[model samples]
Target chain A: MKAVLGNMRAELVGAGGVVERNAYLTKRYIWWDVAWFVWTVANTLTIVFIAKGIEATGGSLDVNETMTTLLIGAVVWAYLGILFEFLMETVAWERWEGTIEYTFMAPLSRAMHLAGQGVFAIAYGLVRAIFLFCVCAFVFFSLSIPDAKYFPAFVVLVVASISFIGIGMMMSVLPLISPEKGTQLGFVAQGTLLVVSGVYYPVSVLPEWMQWIAKVSPATYALDGIRKAILEGQGLSALWSDLWPLLLIGFVSIPLGLWVFQRGEQYAKRHGKLKRSG
Target chain B: MTNIQQAAIEALPRRTAPAVDVRDLSKEFRRRDRKLGRFAHRKRVALDGVSFTMQRGETVAILGQNGSGKSTLVRLLSTLLLPDGGSAEIFGHDVVRDARAVRRLVNRVSVEASFFKKMSSSENLGYASRYYGMTSRQTRDLIPQILGRVGFPPDRRDEPMESLSRGMQQKVALARALLTSPVVLLLDEPTTGLDPRSKLEVQEFIREIRSSHDSTILLCTHDLAEAETLAERVGILDRGQLLAVEPADALRRRFGATTLEEAFFAATGRAFEADDEEDDEDREVFA
Candidate 1:
């Protein structure tokens, strides 16, 4: 028992190392992060303004309702996007720094190392997503809904992050196994997720085949659950349909993602793929 | 042998096990080979059935030309690269089966002083300490002490790694390796590009580590003088094979030569200056 506790303590400290090191790296690259933040805001605003654009075209509709739906889609997509990019970039950043060998050679377990990256990504993503939410929903648009259930929306967001992280962890191995075109492949995966997740529209509007794909995407349920929470004032018990799928995907995907990553890491080590960064 | 003879054999002063035991370890990498606009792949043997052993508290240097499988050997033992054949053991722990135990005991300093360039040296070392399972409080005091011992300036500990000279970066690399218990130090061409002053400084620090820390050191270098002076045993590696491993003076005497450079030529039938091009860090690698 003492040995097990000691090992656990060591793993936790190692995970904290990953978080602290990344925080320092982010501090040095603060300006680049700020620039990316600005671009994220601009892109989200462009999507949200479609409702205003429709009103300008002489369409008779409930402007506030339309804006509220678009806003939820935009902000949640941005939130999901943050987690995706952060996790995917984990591999890219390690390769770019040319420290893949050192990081892999560390005494820490692979699970703990990845957990550190995941924890950091979730924290950082939440910060950016919340900021984007405030800037868009309250500041830029001044939109509000009566009887909104913020707590349930927050719960849905937390659960969805797990599934998102699992997918991201699977993507993280690409760069390790293929140094040349791994990042471009990650972008392709992200684009596919975006199309199938109903980020900017309802899943019912997508083609029947794409709707099938959306059923597997965590973002689909996350977006639906949060929208219902905010727009319909639904509580946790009422959101069971969306919550269970998210939970199922989270539990299954996390372990599968971890297994796939371990195999890819072993492949990298055997092929000398870990040595190449450029 | 009788029971009393067996008891006497066991009582004889003998090391229980070698600090590092490598048996027929080999690694092969596939490289892309293009002929007449057709791309094919070829398997390149980086380390070919190479074997050696290191005693505890011994400092050994491997002398090799470029692309001579030195770095590949180090990487394999460090657990960064998987071997294709045979096995290795560190302090009775198999590298493949007990890699965690090996990782805890070995630290490597490669040719390239790799780090997060934007982060300070202190931050980088602090990060490494945590990965080695050192607590924050331990690293808070240990990082500076190790950094200072390597002749690093205290004022520049907070400066970004990219801002420092290659020599300074090398010092930081050495410091990071020594941050843990000095069990086994793998120095892969550690002073390759350093100026003379920095080279001497690093060499002096290595000597200090051996004498004070009782650490087993594996120094791989192309510099003949550095190998002869800093190492207790100098090994000659050519192509993918270890030609010889013995004390420097004895190696020269065995080859009937004056200097280690001449001894290398006498043994391999090639000038020490000529290097193999088949196996190198920058060679084309394929999955």
Candidate 2:
């Protein structure tokens, strides 16, 4: 029992260290982050403005309601994007910093290292997502949806992050096996998720085959649940159908992602590919 | 600590076996020849049939020119690279089978002092120490202490690593490795790019580490003087093979030469200055 506790303690400390290093990296590159955040805000605004665009042109859609839906979609998309970017670029970050060898050879397990990175990404992504959502809804769009239940919407966002992180973790393995093109390949997963996950639109709009693919993406459930909660003022009890799938994906994908990453790491070590950009 | 933890700690000193036991260790790289054929590939044997052992607290230097498998050997021992053949055991823990244990026992300082350049020196050290299981309280004291011992400027601890000189960066790297007092400290050309004064300070710091810590040092370098002065035994690695590993004086005597440089020439059958594939195409297959 004592040994188990000690091991847990070590893992926690090691994971915390990974998060702390990233925080330091973030702090050091604060200006760059700010620039990216501004870009993200603008992107969010452009998507949410589509609702206003339709209303301005005399479309029959309810302007405020359409704007809120778009706003929620854009916010979730931004959150998921940040989460995936942080996790997927983990290897790129280590290599760019020329610390891949040191990190790979550390006593800490790969799982713990990734968990620390996950913690940082979730927290950072959530903060950005909240601010983005606020800017798009209240400041820029002046969206006021009566009877909207925000608490349940937040719960959906929090739960959905688990599955997104799992998928992100799986994508992070690409750079380990193929450093030359692996980082670019990570975006393929993101792009696929974006296409099939119904980020800015409803699932009913996608074709039959694409809708089948959308069913597998946790973001599909996430968008569904958040819309129900925020637009229709649904509670968690009514959102159980969406919540369980996210939980299941989180359960299976995290372990599967860890397994895939370890295999990729072994392949890298055998091929002598862990060195920085070589 | 539990009984298991206590037992593991107590069993750390396997005096019966060498601190590092590498047997017939080999590693090869598969490189493609785009100029030759579309699918043509050849193997470069970076380390071929190399075997050595280090006793507890021993400092052995492997002197080699560029691409002579010095870094490959260090990387293999540190669990950063997998060996193609043979086996290496660190204090009874196999590098492959018991990599986690070996990782705890070993730390390496490579030729390039890699760090998060945006972070401060203290911040980098703090990250390293924490990953090795040291708490914040411990690193708070140990980071500055280790930096001081390695001659890092106390005033510059908070400055970004990129702003620091290469010599200073190298100091931080060494400090990170020694933060946990690893049993086997692998220094792969730690002073390779330092200026003369900085080189001397690094060498001095290494000697201090040798005397102060119980760490067994495996110093791989191209510097002949560094091999002679810092290590009790010197090894000459040419191409992919180890020609000799012995005391500096003994090597010179065996080669019937008055100087260590002459001994290197005698063993490798080439002038010290002229030995290498630096300018050549290096397309030769190892076999």
Model 1: lDDT of residue B129: 80
List interface RMSDs for the candidates, in order: 1.3, 1.6
- Candidate 1, residues A192-263, lDDT tens digits: the string is 886798776788999999999999998899989988998899999999999999999999999988898899
DockQ of each: 0.67, 0.69
Structural similarity to truth (TM-score) of each candidate: 0.94, 0.96
Name model 1 segments beyond 4 Å from true.
B1-15, B36-39, B276-287
Stretches of model 2 off by over 4 angstroms after superposition: B1-13, B275-287
Give model 1's TM-score versus the native structure.
Answer: 0.94
Quality of model 1 by C-alpha lDDT: 0.84
Could you tell me the lDDT of residue B266 within candidate 1?
Answer: 95
What is the per-residue lDDT of model 2 for residues B1-287, given as tens digits with 9 covering 90 to 100?
A: 22322344465856577888998999988878888799998677888888989998899999877777888889899998899999999998899999988888889998899998889999998887777777898678778888998888799999999999999999999998888778889999999989999899999999998997777899999899999999999999877788999999999999999998999999988776563564213522221
Model 2 interface CAPRI class: medium
